[model samples]
Target chain A: MGTLYEDRLAEHIGKECPPIEAVDTVCPETIRHWIEIMEDRNPAYSDAEWAAGSRFGSIVAPGAMMQVWSMAPHWPQRDLPELPIAPVDEVLISEGFTDVVATEQSQQIHKLAKIGEPVTFTVKLTKVSDREHKTRLGVAYFVTFEYRFTDPRGDLLGTQSFTYMRYRPEPESESADEPAA
Target chain B: MPTDWMKPHLKYDSVAWEDVSEGDELPTHVREIDTSLVVLGAISAARDFYPVHHDKDAAIAAGAPDVFLNILTTNGLMASFVTNWCGPDWDVTDISLRLLIPAFPGLKLTTTGTVARKYEEDGRQMLDVEFGAGTDYGPHCKGTATLRRP
Candidate 1:
């Protein structure tokens, strides 16, 4: 709704954000914890017996847990990287779309991850919707990022494309029938 | 527990691609999106430090009545909904879901899928499944998953 958004914000599409930090080699402890929380004891994930009998022939991390390796940390660290996604979000929030919500996510699980294989990810801000859309929440724009997961040998483990809607919520008018934003 | 007819055979705990055809239906799985999973399963596991996920106050400030489910958790649950039926041998190559409802605590998200199209591609046995998940807020996610069956 402002000149800044029309003139400057639209210029951010196709921008390349910084790469996420490399993680230490993948370990079973982290995968075990995730499996415990989701209660997804799919023998492939936890039961040694199931995995050994399965096609993989060994324990494999849940493909959905691919994001845990790259998301924001639970605690703030002084040496935290600049968060490759900051500029994309900060620019939107600066435009008065203070409310943010995950709108869609698409992931491709290429190869099942084996325990002890290292994983790292790099993200690129692919698109920032140029058009303003309205929803029950308010006015918003969509932000999309593509992530590539890799192992130490630079082999791709998987890939995910996530999109979020950044909007200014009008909580007073929450309605299910409201038009799409 | 699954019966003998449902158990996986040999090395793959899944249905063979030859046995499945287009228009086949997938079983529905109803999973709870409770407080613990929202806070512990979704946020803690993903290490998403956003207070909006753990702190109710922060979530309220973010225009949410309570802490809500995160995408990572939803992805996991949705994938499971499919794999749980396909068996451990099936491969989920692509899963795309769009969030329409904010899954709040105490809400149970039920998932249902229909085999939309089954075909061969790139030397792989593949099928496209259309899936949807719903809460009281209406459909929370609508998406498609592409899978390879052995």
Candidate 2:
């Protein structure tokens, strides 16, 4: 396998390809579990009567819950067969890419996701950048990617932008000179 | 007489509206960022490929001081603090956050907020909530939030 930097960059720049893949996952249990774990006592997420009387008209998933749901499809083990896509972990690990970092993330909630509604997430690698910084190993390249989320009906729910910088380790003896300056 | 179902978490049930002031400080909420929660949050949010969140070595190699906090996790923490204080009756209308410093794993962070301004907007009571997160090192993030009272 070649370096992830080389492979991903090639695919991104050469093929005019989108570095990130879009995938979807649906499991009512996931949302239910989140509500329980967080101890979210909000009637909109737990009580049928309260939810029915609310604007959403059902036990809608919390905004933060929907954010979590959006990322479920990227886990390595699920290997969403319908999409024929690799989990983000497998994809990065396969290309000998390591050290992914999220520099920033911003989300805007447009609407709520109701219970029993199959929430579909569309993860796309919106941008990629190669950055070089002086380190013990001199300079290294860093790659960043962004992912956006939407519902099954194609209504925009929120957007999450993640920046990951990838690079190899620097060799020793490269910075042996020591000068007090 | 029937009891109010939402009485437990309501401000009216305990404290009176006259007690809270524009500059009065709310109780502070503190948390330490652990690698496990950070990783779980990152993966769960579909931010799957970032190793710097889970891999310490990767973070060092990338030019970051350490496995830094993701923006989503920071936002979640801020939102949670507000919700915890205001109770479930209030809803978060908007949140604007700015990260000042990197919050690494094991760092002690304290979240503090104050009522900046309050007014009636469209027949609903609104509170201009200002929040911030700080560590022993310094401030990590500062922002304002809009909360509507029921």
Candidate 3:
């Protein structure tokens, strides 16, 4: 990667992107679909009777269902004009660093959202590795994107932090020339 | 990334907060990763279209053995592992994960957790549980999460 390009990448740090628009609200139907794949038979996530008789008094969405609320759409549509929240992935792809992988993730939930409440997200470019890393996947740069989720009533749900490695795989030959970073 | 529901489904009574002791062992949860629908459902649920998670040729080209599981799915698995063991009222408050190896199609993941500490914090019954998933690749994923039994 050129120094100028690297500098441009560095510029992304601290940049805040607009929140995803029209986030799907949580509902029993959505919750059921998730528990099906997870086999998460916890009554609270699915059984209305069990949930209503409990402290929550209604069916509660699983707290771990947080990230699914704000994942990047499979088909990309431009939502925010002030800041295109998803450019780092594009930059990585453009730079031939196409092998993407998640390295770490963490979340702190203020509380779980209720059914019929919409979930929205806002993210910030938290970090760009100062130095390139070498691995079986060739030279890679670490990109960390942090997300915050809120419900329709302006209540805080939780904040999720995850890191992705944008890597270019090394060629088969042991002595092949490598790109400059 | 489990697709079909368990054959003999489970019915659980909410574990009493007082009954859970520090150093208690939680039940093990096994996740069989079938590359077909199971893994696909997981990635699709997250809307994660990254090729490494799907598309066999793209995954091989990207240096992965095959279409592999994504972290969001792992997060769900980890949460379910804890919540299932702690019973109905128990919920996950915080979870942090570190992946040591890629979980592939043929892999079988056996997840277990140990209660590290149980205490009352601000009148909330809390347990800090350390959990891990064992795969064909050895120790695959490990993390600690806080679960609250109210």
Candidate 4:
């Protein structure tokens, strides 16, 4: 199973996943929701009047909210579309590396997330570990993926490189040895 | 959305790029994590429905002690931390984060940062800041963020 999946993962290297368009634009309602939850009081993000006088000349979404725009909706179960990393995940899961954890995320902003603007995200599978490595949870493989955010004109807005560790869960009996201290 | 959550407090109008120097320390900011921040930040704010971020049982099943904050929320907190220190006139041009540990609920997340470099690129003033957030378990995450001033 390990060798079979490992070879499958090797085939996906450097392939770009299909781009996903945001269901909503960069609008005030969504921005406000993020700001409220984050408790961020930045005038540039909420106060239109104050923002108009600033360098941005208008209210802008939080730079960190870039990824939120393109998230897949939570309701209305349909034939689930293959997620960007689903293919790779399938290979990992076949070998019992079921649980995943995000380890690193780095992003570069080229354009601000302006209100009413729609953003699209494109992901590319960059790297897959050649061999398994032992992790605290169990054995795992590290996968690296890159995300590119663009606008309607295809102008680059930002880019993020994210890394996740796909690991097998320890047996219940083994974990129970150190139950929550 | 209700506007009542908006706070009235404001930081400085802006930190001029010309005035900032390398090695300058930013004001430390602290936040108390609760189950609400973890869940809301995942589902409502970030639109992330990852179970480990909101369900303790799921997290424990996956080997975590409890529900923990997600990467998107940490990114938001990092942005807020920097802007609160440098004010709002600047825009984030880059942010790189490495997760060292899980930020579980009931811990005080203390964040600190320092201006690492000052330079000009493409006619815009740029600053690279090294920052990190930590809990009682040690560093939760740390990275550098680049800010551009117009």
Candidate 5:
């Protein structure tokens, strides 16, 4: 009747992982590519002159784009080396840890990210908990992580708080498909 | 004269200082959650790498009735809906959201918000907007957003 939560928590507790950081360098091409890929038509992210005239003075990356920037460093690229990443769900899943679900996401934008401005990201684990949802009849563990982004001048650009719930299969009688309590 | 940046055009203002009432409903908009777009969005947002969002087989194996939307994507959709209505000039000061149900893939999500309250804070005109998004299953997400006109 034990759950994967207990073992996952024990492995993560008191473990230290290298933080992710990058330069503030971004270009119009990068911004355009992201917009095109995401199908975002916001002028603030497309038209340079329009963005320049605004309070930000240039096209800024979308708040959601920052989340991608934060994770980029953790991933391996053919060009960048020496950047260590602590494998989380994606990698762990390949190694037998399964049942990852996004529980929550929140973001706060302080300043706009202009083209060619290097925005750095740093991530850290904040919380982890094991819970049994009787209603769903699932064994799940909640993991919370914090990400901070800053401009080259050390000014706070934004902060993102992400919460994830990873669950596992239960017995037939205790399945998540059961009727609500 | 760069396209006459200051050129005057037909202007019609809807909400006046006194016309707004508490608990008034704002116009709602529907955003179809394209499964492919949702998966791309999840990767772009660096959200939890849950296959229920990207891989159909993984989702089915994970015990999900089917592939579903990610919470982060839902929040972004809600924010985008409000921002689209409020125009590009408004700044989102705060958003408090709660996930109430699971949104299955390919289902169109209807996002609506109401003017919960209107008041002046720190000499700025602010509106307390509450938003809810749902599909056929029920309400998927609910939250309150604090918006200020710049």
Candidate 6:
């Protein structure tokens, strides 16, 4: 509705933040849990004996789990820093555009994560819509971030570009100048 | 329980890179979408805390019919589809995804793909597979995945 939020988002474009490491290193337990839920039965991901004979020579984390390895932890309430995009989302929320949804993602994998390796990620705001984009739900702004995932040795494992649509719901009735309580 | 007890019984053979053709078709993989997939996939698997992915009321309020699959899980499923077809030795080098519709509970998700290109890059045999997943409501997601042969 105003240029304030757009100006705020523009300032963040192309800004990269410090890399954040995963709370836990890549481990077998988490990999098992993920493939179990997805019903992925690939022997290289689950069977130790089979993977030992396979080209990998050991169990490997699923290539698709690249982002999962760096996802923020939920429980125990550790004192982790906020992602670089938190402030950008705050700027949008301040203007009543609170809801957000992932609309697209693209990943480039240089290497799959291996067991016992610590994964870290650095994120940069890549793009922001110059104007409001109208969608089925409501008028919105699209924000995109690029994430680079790397191993402890600083070797890149993968890269992902994630895009989210942030929007406010349309009012059912035409009400103007509604007072804030 | 011992990890040995967790191993699944092997059923399929690996696809060798030497035999892959540009027009080769991958076997279709079908999954039943339910509450467990939508919830556990978001929370325990993908570690996504986004309310719309796990909370039904929150999803409705956010303009979704119900709790839907998160992007990471969707990508994971797509990866599984490719690996399941190509077997255990190959490496997936890239995945590009475009979301069209929500994969909701009660829908049967089916993925099908074709090898779009077969070539050698930097002495590594590579295959680019164009894949798409859909349900009764039409296509849900589509993408191209690049696989490196071992």
How do the candidates score on chain B by TM-score?
0.86, 0.82, 0.86, 0.92, 0.80, 0.93
Off by over 4 Å in 5: A1-19, A22-41, A73-97, A130-137, A171-181, B1-21, B44-50
lDDT of prediction 3: 0.74
Better of 1 and 5 by DockQ: 1
Best by DockQ: 4
Query: How many steric overlaps are in each model, in order?
Result: 0, 3, 0, 0, 6, 0
Q: Between candidates 1 and 4, name the one with more favorable DockQ.
A: 4
Model 2 chain B worst lDDT run, 10 consecutive residues: B7-16
Alpha-carbon runs more than 4 Å astray in model 2: A1-28, A32-43, A46-56, A75-107, A119-181, B1-20, B44-49
What lDDT tens digits, residue by residue, belong to model 1 across residues A2-117? 56556766566555545555454555677766765665535676666667777877777878888777755445543554544577688777778888788889898887778777
- Mark the regions of model 4 whose C-alpha exceeds 4 Å error after superposition: A1-6, A78-81, A171-181, B1-7
Give Cα-based local distance difference scores for all models: 0.74, 0.56, 0.74, 0.82, 0.62, 0.82
Once fitted onto the true fold, the runs of candidate 1 whose alpha carbons sit more than 4 angstroms away are A1-6, A22-24, A49-57, A76-84, A172-181, B1-12
Candidate 3 lDDT, tens digit per residue, A1-181? 5673466577777887666744577777767777776778787767666666877777778887788776555566646544433676677778777776787888887878778777878888788776667754577777787888887777888888887777877864343232211
Docking quality level of the chain pair in candidate 6: acceptable
Candidate 3: misplaced stretches above 4 Å? A1-6, A72-78, A81-87, A171-181, B1-12
Q: For residues B1-150, could you state the per-residue lDDT of candidate 1 as single tens digits?
A: 222332232224567778788888898888888778888866556767667778889888877789988877777777777776776667888999888777888888888999899898888788899998888878888889888865
- TM per candidate: 0.86, 0.61, 0.86, 0.90, 0.75, 0.90
- What interface RMSD, in Å and to 1 decimal, does model 3 have? 5.6
Clashing pairs in 4: none
Q: Which parts of model 6 are misplaced by more than 4 Å?
A: A1-6, A171-181, B1-8
Please provide TM-scores computed only on chain A for all of the candidate models, following their numbering. 0.80, 0.58, 0.81, 0.85, 0.68, 0.87
Tens digit of lDDT per residue, candidate 5, span A77-144?
42433221244464345544355556566677676577777777766666666544433525555567
Please provide, for model 3 over B93-112, each residue's C-alpha lDDT reduced to its tens digit, 9 standing for 90 to 100: 89988876778888898999
